[model samples]
Target chain A: MSTGAVIEFTSISKRFGGVAAVKDLSFTVEPGRVTGFLGPNGAGKTTSLRILLGLVAASSGTATFGGVRYRDLPHPLKTVGAALEAASFHPGRTARDHLGVYAIAAGLPRTRVMEVLTLVGLAAHAAQRVGGYSLGMRQRLGLAYALLGDPGVLVLDEPINGLDPEGIRWIRGFLRDMAAEGRTVLVSSHLLSEVQQSVDDVVIIARGELVHLGPLSSLDTDAAPQTIVESPDREALAAALTAAGITFSIGRTGLLAATGDPALLGHLAFTAGVELSVLHRQKAGLEDSFLALVGGGHTL
Target chain B: MTMFLRSVSAEFAKIFTTRLWWILAIVLFGYIGLLAGGLAALFAGIQTGVISPDAVNTGGGPTDFGSLPPLIYSFASSVGYVFPVLLGALATTGEFRHQTLTPTFLATPRRGLVLGAKTVTLVLIGAGFGVVALAASVGIGGGVLSAFGVDALLQGAETWLLVARTLLAMGLWAAIGVGLGALVPNQVASIVIVLAFTQFVEPLLRLAASFLEVTAKIGNFLPGAASDALVGASVFTMASPAGTAPLDWWQGGLVLLGYALIATVIGYAVSWKRDVT
Candidate 1:
């Protein structure tokens, strides 16, 4: 990995017709980190990335690469490589020829095509037409294209969508390796668990608005742990917490609530004559933190 | 300059990588050869009194039997015109259709530069289509004409002039197609307009105007007519009413160029302002 340039989006907003697709969205992706841009469907993740790539115009604000606009980059491919989707390819073209077109446009030598294909593990299928490629293969080819410039900054949108578990693992490690080398990698995904494993930092958005932006660990994890307490007398446990002025919410198979320590809750339950069957601290993972910030759903 | 070269090279690779152009190339060659050969055989029958010359003239053919050879050769452009149009439309619209334009625009951020590169690349390939059309029409049609005892006139300077003009005309058709494709990136609609206008609608309009005194003059400015006047060998030239001199070759070239220029300019305007998404 190499030290990569910072990607800055300052107050970026994009409107389609009268609908506000992205409104006043602002964040910065720093060097040497794998940043996950997690958002729900229609949350403007793709739109923001498109604006950064200059594929779509921003209704307001600026997206800059190292403080330079993408269009103004002397050699764009050399600075930032982006893959919005795996299907943005010509089906009739073979993998090598498809990359060859970009190679020519970027003024890169033909050998770079093969190198990137090998990097993405598509070298064996390089001669095969993209029409015959499976969804996983197309995803690999898309990644191969993004890496063709050997760019310091990579922006991929839902790159893991069609990959198998092994391929997903490969990409997770690949992105980590890229960031480990100090290359800036911003991957947009709606899958919270997948992103949690792959990213060091996360910038989450909901309804086209920035929900939270910070390191993945900075997401409400250290504040206090949620305690899942189950009792033979569930109503007694709930009543005990309520009388004691400790708020509790009923959860599946338990009375769920957040507290500073499980020991305090355990002592309170014993004194209240609420026989506790289960009491344990539930560690908040990225998925839980993301759901807390963006609202509850199975995935971000 | 080097960037432009690279862009053009990419366009060439794009064209060759797909089976689209070569398939159209074969269509252009085979269609022109088959049509021109059939016309030569018809003229041979007319010369032998097997078919009435009057019958051919009524069907929008030349009245003078001697003009049939050049007319048939010039018909090569008429027969081969759609392929270039299809080629140009598919070249640009294929990008949008396949969503490959995202990467294309990403690789080369200047949209105008990308479009200009397409124009340059298509012109040469369009001219190459012209060469193929010319070869097939002359090779097959001339042989048929000679076998029928008509003077094929393959050696004449006029014959070569028609060939050169045919090449130029086909190139212009391709330029127009590129412009149209750019103007309307929708593949189905572009293909529809090209086929409907060039194949049937324009020819009917030309024939209808040829019958009138006032409208005949205005019809000369039509793209198909201008292209025919440029080539100096359209079947419409014979059908044109007497005493009205159609546009000279130079004027016809300008008119054809004007359409390409207008279409491209407007296409560029829309493309420059619109988002690719």
Candidate 2:
């Protein structure tokens, strides 16, 4: 497995008429990791991917693969495999025949078509026309097409949309394995929880702007975990918090919230002679962090 | 050159893999065969005197009702042109309808090259339709004429020229069909527009133009009129007033080619540059 290319989007913006689909979107997807492109349905995730693939011209800025434009790649398929949509196929052609067209276009051998078909577990249905394929099969066929060229980087958009639970689990493991092989894997979806276990990095965007981007591990590290404390004498605890210059806010749940070492908060509470009924460090999960970052009204 | 050939081969695979070509081919044979057989029977009736000479002879100049081989040969191309046009239109619009254009463009990002390959493929397929139409016309019409003891003149050089010109005309119509597809990627709309133009619009305009001096000169440049002239003979030409004459054979070919070129250029301008998604 080779170290995959870095996908860089530098200040890219796209506008469809008066609506700005994407604006000043900038991020870097490093090699050897699965990066989840998270955003809502109208968040321009598909448009950005389309722009990167050279299907749609950007209104401004550049999206490059390993520092080169997608259009200028000597062999685009060899460098990057993109499965932007599951329905990008003719219904009349069989699975093998559909792959054969791309295989020929990319100058690959006929055997590669069979190889990819087998890899995607579509070998049994190779002769089946795509029109008869279920949504899950179409998704698998799209993946097979992406793997045809044995590309270094893989881009899949909402790959798990129509999949059953088993299929989704299989895809998650498959994506992780691809990343383990040193290929850059970028998977886009509105649901972060679906890709939570598979991705190493998360790039969150909302309304066409980057809201947060970094490793999933480091995402919670940016802010200290809040130390939640509840006391029988709320007034005394509040007064002590103010006098010690340990500013805190009252949560909707009637608990005092303060960010610091949990032990330190305990020490302060003891020193202030405040009797506490409850005291614990509240660690924010990725889902909460994502919702907070994107704001209210949007679900996980 | 190798890339172009590969694109062409991929295109050929796309057409043959689907049942569209076979259905269209069958329709072409059936349509041309009906025209040839029906006309042959009419002329056979005239020769046998089952239809009176007064009833056959109309106001137009003397037409050899039973003896003319050129009219039978002309049906192979002039009346058969629409099938190739439908095939060409379907070839392009089918991609849009089925959403296959996305993958095709993804494989060959150069949109112009893909269109070029399709144009070349459709033209060849159109010429194939020409050959089938010619074979049906000659086989059925020639047999009927010979059975009626009329001189079908199937052995003459003029008859072969008609055959050659018919093939060229069908090829051009195929190109024109591709142009229409490019301009209008919507399958139903392209079919409706192509059918309406070839069947009702152009024929009526041509007939209406037959009365006006300037419109007639301009109408000679109409695609169907040019196609009619390219084949060198048609029922319309046989029935038209004597003063109205279409362009010469070479000129008609040029005029048809011009429509295709203009259509392709405009199509590229309007739709090719737009994003696939």
Q: What range of 10 consecutive residues in model 1 chain A has the weakest lDDT sum?
A: A291-300
lDDT of 2 by residue, B1-277 (tens): 7667878888887888888888888888888888887887677667676667678655654535534678877888878899999999888888888777777776777778888888898889899999899888888877777777777787888988988899889988998988888899889999999999988998888888877778888888989889889888887777666347789999999999998888887887777667767
- The 0-to-1 C-alpha lDDT of every candidate, in the order given, reads 0.86, 0.85
Tens digits of lDDT, candidate 1, A1-300: 224899999999999999999999999999889999998888899999999999899999999989999999888888898988889888999999999999999998899999999988989999999999999999999998888888999999999999999999999999999998889999999877877887888999988899998888788565666788989998888888888787777889687776757898899888998899999977767677788777778352
RMSD of each: 3.0, 3.9
Residue-wise C-alpha lDDT for candidate 1, range B1-277, written one tens digit per residue:
8889989999999999989888989888888899889877886778766677766655664445566678888877866878887898888878888998899988999888898899888888988999999888888888888887888898899999989988888888888888998799899999999999988999889888877778889998999899888888766676666536789988988898899889988988876347877
DockQ of each: 0.81, 0.55
Clashing pairs in 2: none
Give a tens-digit lDDT track for model 2, residues A1-300: 235999999999999999999999999998899999998788889999999988899999899999988878877777888898889888988999998987777677889999998988899999999999999999999999888889899999999999989989999999999998999999998887889989999999888999999998856753646778878898898887788787778975445566646677678779999998878877767777787777745753
